[model samples]
Target: MTNREKYNQAFIETLEITADQLGDDLTYQSIEAWDSVGHMQLVSALEDAFDIMMDTDDIIDLSSYPLGIEILKKYDVEFS
Candidate 1:
């Protein structure tokens, strides 16, 4: 899967949401499913999916779906 697909899948699995429900507008606490607990789950899922350990700052800075791409790019994760 491409990086975009992997990113979406991480959110899908971690947030227990459908793919159709995800978007750039999707942010932390934007939905009931993306609460504090869900945020950490997403962090873990993204780490597992991308095979990289994110710094605490990056993890905390990942406040939105679009921001995720930017943050992941710092780890050399390219999106297509």
Candidate 2:
């Protein structure tokens, strides 16, 4: 799968949501499934999917879908 797909899957599987629910509007605490625990799970999933260890600051900074992409970029994960 592509990096984008891996990213989406991290959110989808971690949050127990469907791919159709993924979007730029997706943000932490925006859904019942994305609470504090879910946030850590999503962070773990992203780390596993991208094979990168994110700093605590980045994990905390990843509050939105668009921002996640930016944070991943800091680790050299390219979407395209």
Candidate 3:
């Protein structure tokens, strides 16, 4: 699967959110399901999906969907 597909699947499965609800603007505080526990789940899901280990900085800085994409790119995950 593509990066976008992987990202979407991870977000959907971990966040329990629909495709329409996901976007670069999506933030932890923006959704009821994206609490602290869900944040950790999201981090784990992203790591598992991308097969990349994230640093504490990346984990803490991944505050939004766009930021997540940016951080993942640092791990060599091409968005395209």
Best by TM-score: 2
lDDT of 2 at 44: 96
Candidate-wise lDDT, in order: 0.92, 0.93, 0.90
lDDT of 2 by residue, 1-80 (tens): 99999999899899999988888889999999999999999999999998999999999999998899999999999988
Q: Provide the TM-score for each candidate, comma-separated.
A: 0.94, 0.96, 0.95
lDDT, candidate 3, equals 0.90
Per-candidate alpha-carbon RMSD to the true structure = 0.8, 0.7, 0.8
- Residue 22 in model 3: lDDT: 85
Summed over model 2, clashes come to 0
Model 1 TM-score? 0.94
Return the candidate ranking by TM-score, descending.
Answer: 2, 3, 1
- Total backbone collisions for each predicted model: 0, 0, 0
Writing each residue's lDDT as its tens digit, candidate 1 over 1-80 gives 88889999999988988987888779999999899899999999999999999999998999998899999999999997
